[model samples]
Target chain A: MINNAGPSNSAAVLDEGVGPPSLSRLSDADLSSMLLIRHFEKNLLKLFEQGFLHGTTHTCLGQEYVPVTVTSLLGDADHVFSNHRGHGHYLARYADAEGLLAELLGRAGAVCGGVGGSQHLLRERFLSTGVQGQSLPVAAGVAWNLKRSTPGALACVYTGDGTWGEGVVYEALNITALWELPLLVVTENNGIAQSTPTGQHMAGDVRGRAAAFGIAYERFTDTDVTRLRAALQPLVEQVRHMSRPLVVEFVTHRLGPHSKGDDSRSPAELRAVRAADWALRYAAAHPEQFERIDAEQSRRVEQVVAEVLARPLTDWSPR
Target chain B: MTAPRVANDLNTALHRLFAEDERVILLGEDVCDPYGGAFKVTRGLSTRYPHRVRNTPISEGALVGVAGGLALAGDTAIAEVMFADFVTLAFDQLVNFASKSTAMYGRHLPLRLVVRCPTGGNRGYGPTHSQTPQKHLIGVPGLALYEASPLHDNHTLLTRILDGGVPAVLFEGKVLYGERMFTGGVIDDLYGYDLADGVARIRLHDPVPPDCVLITSGAMVHRTVEALRELLLHDEIVAEVLVVSRLYPVERAPLLSLTGPARRVAVIEESTAGGTWGAEVATALHPHLWGTLASPIRLIHSLDSIIPAAAHLERQVLVQSGTIRHAVKELVHG
Candidate 1:
């Protein structure tokens, strides 16, 4: 069992806007996925401005490396449960940029037939719901099933730091630990929940909460996708072999607003958050591959947007 | 077997389910040995299928949510709520998560999950512990609702629901746990009924066009049955009794056929009168039988308030046998 991660630590980290640990270069695949999500979200905000999109969307801008690294370790047999800010999670797993864009535009060929909008997505071995804290138990159940039916497979669920306030998360953690179910709980602790900072909304910390349930807890303060993947490989293997639950907390940053145009932070705080952005670090480490892939993925997203926007609306009707 | 009570029948059904299907999992508070659930419907189930029958903590929402996940992974899960009132604690998982998971995805995910909610208040459990909360779940898409009755077989209902692969809520009447399962012949040695499409229709005196029809379900069934018998014997007003178990997405075809002979109808329920299943049934049946009905279908429900713990006060708050009798008489004459 783990003890308190202590208080005001997140505040110290968030207020300072200290940059993440300096790391080695990332692989082409990892950099491409990170840039792809970056282009997707940046394009979504612009599309909102251009009248091609309506409704609200939560963009995983600076936190793209979290899913891009974690999902690279999952297999087709393993399940992934994503929260509201799940575009990066989906793109990291399947790279269905056109399907996701079509979904956002409610166009034909959209994933989920345009029923599940920006916050909801479904595909093989993956599901996302807009509501917070509801996916934990479902993911635990999937993990329980995997332990029995699939043997070596595991279920990974992504949640925001704010979602820790939901009682269902603790309930799920208790069961996952008690049953020794193969579940990986990934908390993208971007230091804020919607408009509220973590210090105001959460108490103690996620590490203490996971410890209370006798689950193993790990933390990531760096954005090097390759290094994070190397560290996660053994942890994920333990989850499969022992069929025990694990909580991986990524103390990352959110460069964008909680949603479109909802940044309640000041310029100083925003600058602090920018310090944690991996794009600058990735570019600084390997400028050539970073520049080439960024431009390529950016153009790829532009073409995806144009093609998806031109398609007809989906024909799915309610029963 | 004929003398086995509703609880015994349910226990037997669960035993059969566990013996036959290894993938069927049970999760709830104290559902294992020495507890066998709050209603004891899960008695002796865990001893046989130890791995499948589990004792969950007091987390209603997560248990239901987890059950949905298990079912989504090709396992049939039965989640038991200690009492019907606690089902409220699991509303988000049931209504939002499990309900939407069925169709929100591109395709329908066959979620083979059944939440057994032991409901109704006849044991003086009072406000928070006693309630027939099925009305709260009325009309939720992809959520099938059923209730235990003296007329229906638990094994048949559970088997059929699991076979269809739709997520369901089986509202077991806590009051019916000790009552003997009705097999055939005269019910309460009073009336004869026919079972069709999981709905039971009782004719009190003879097969004549009823002057008043009484529609009710679950723990309220016997009360309505006794009321119809009284109406026939004393008032000589032949009445019909339609006891429904499947409460949601009301089957119009079978209901219309079963209710064809009904003239003045009244929907009697225990869960107070306000946007209820009774109201839904009346609305579904009204326009189709508009001019045919002597009057607009009446909804007879308990007084809109919390269930009291005291016996007399509880009686005043809940529907009774006499309550159904008096309501039907008013529907026939008033």
Candidate 2:
């Protein structure tokens, strides 16, 4: 069962979310999930700096609230395919920190045997392309296959704002809308792709592009994870019941630069905004509960660190 | 003893294979229902097995990508490129993604995915739809390439590619789709011949005296075989003709074995001469079989330019029977 651990009073965030009405409601536990994602990202940055990691990573530091809220809208049978910045989406669903860290470290104990390093991180059935935008078409393919053979499982794809410009994305989107494939496409609008801002790069509106192809569309900001969950709820239910395509334009911010490559890294403005975000606020208000949540998350992260650090280096070489 | 010769059409060739294996699935644009396919190769496949045959919307990237995924998931999928030219649209998916998916992951592709692309020129298909770019996809490590020359073997090769447990590109000659060939005995399915590492010698005339070997593939094979017979001035100067079916894991052993004792050898193709098949064969054969050769390997190929629309100009650009005959004659006399 999915654990519902956030403070219990956040349900109101759903009824009056900024976007359209939501069919699926986010729980207090779902809100706690966002805090967990932020914690995971912090741990990753530390692991990366300490020389315990190899390969590139696209951290979803600012975009954590989207996947946390959106995935909670999906059922168990529903599958998701996310792009390079996928840790948020996968962990919100499977919640396995050890596998993600092991995968990033390129250890044999990693999920994909380190063949898939940081960017190519994966969990049991929740898959990530680890490459930008490449996962979009594959997700469409998975949706087509799932709809044709299994009937109940739904397919979801999480892509970046930069990814919308790729031809393969359009090809798959056109075909997905044409076939009315049962898929939920979430555009993680993090304002910047690597270092290029969306205004300078993306043309027009992402929702309009979907509407031009006759797809149902919705948009929401990331500050309130509960509202984001509510916005995704209706579409998730509609897709499951009707087996049609939907596009969710998530207005989120990248709290960090693209990767460790960015010299400038985080700014004070984002940190100030993040300080007041709902996830941290909820954790603080539920101090009695926060104590339990913090301890558990700490234990989880520690257990993961120990597990990864304790493993011996594998003697394999790439051909 | 042979199935009665029927009108050679792409549909018939596909049907013959569909009747042979249940694993052979047709996935591409208009492959089912109203359209049957852009070229109608999969015309009636959906009528018999609705679950297996699929008609996807115009998603070339997904067509190859999903086929790779399904192959990874254990299904033999025959992905069709409506025209060889459109394959450019899905180039990254095929070369960077599907071709390397198995080898990069350190896993054997249990997927038998055959990309059937209608290649070469004849129809006024113009620049966008009439290019032979199979050479572009050859460098991928895990893929096996095939250019089916005859109509009958196209069906056999499809069956073999799906059964062989390897990803393959089976190029169907747009020129030879409906053509008829009259012969005395049954032509063995080229699939029965090993296509690993080099070329196979298909003889048109017996007792080839082994003066010079004419090596070629695809549509050029038929013309080269015919040229060997028409230009033979004497029984002593025999021209051994080697036709390669697999381009990647090319049938090299047989080609090496055939040219090991020959005094001279020449490689011919319809594609540009220097960088591809001609260059590859010359590079491979020159080192190991250099001492045995009486003359440096000659390459007879089309001029490096866009295939023209004019019939005469097109013929001049492609390797013809006379071109092969002349190359062999020159190599033999050199």
Clashes of each: 0, 16
**What lDDT does each candidate get?**
0.86, 0.67
DockQ list for all candidates: 0.79, 0.34
Q: Second chain only: TM-score per model?
A: 0.97, 0.84
- For model 1 the TM-score comes to 0.96
lDDT of 2 by residue, B1-334 (tens): 3442222444676777767766556788878966787665677789977877877777787777767655644466788888887887777777766666554443343467888888877565655666777778766776778877652355555666777776778877676655553234323332122233434555433343567877777666567656765665542356766767776665566778766688788888777655676777787778877777887989987778788777777777766787777777777766
lDDT, residue A35, model 2: 57
DockQ leader: 1
The runs of at least 3 residues in candidate 1 whose Cα sits more than 4 Å from the true structure, single-residue gaps closed, are: A1-19
- In candidate 2, what are the lDDT values of residues A1-319, reduced to their tens digit? 0011121101112222353232233354764576577777878788778877675677887566777777777776667776778888878897767767766776556666666666554454466665566666766666766676667667788888788778777777777777677888888775667766566566676877887888888877545655555557877888877888888877565666588758342454345435434545555556566566656676677777878878765444444
Provide the TM-score for each candidate, comma-separated: 0.96, 0.86
lDDT of 1 by residue, B1-334 (tens): 3678889989999888988888999999999998888888898988878888889889999999999999988899999999989998899998898888889976777888999998989789998887888889998988888888888888998998888677899998888899888777457655788899888888853477778777778788778777777888898888888888788877777788888856788888789778788999998999888978888899988888999999999999899988878877788888
The worst-scoring run of ten residues by lDDT in candidate 2 chain A lies at A1-10
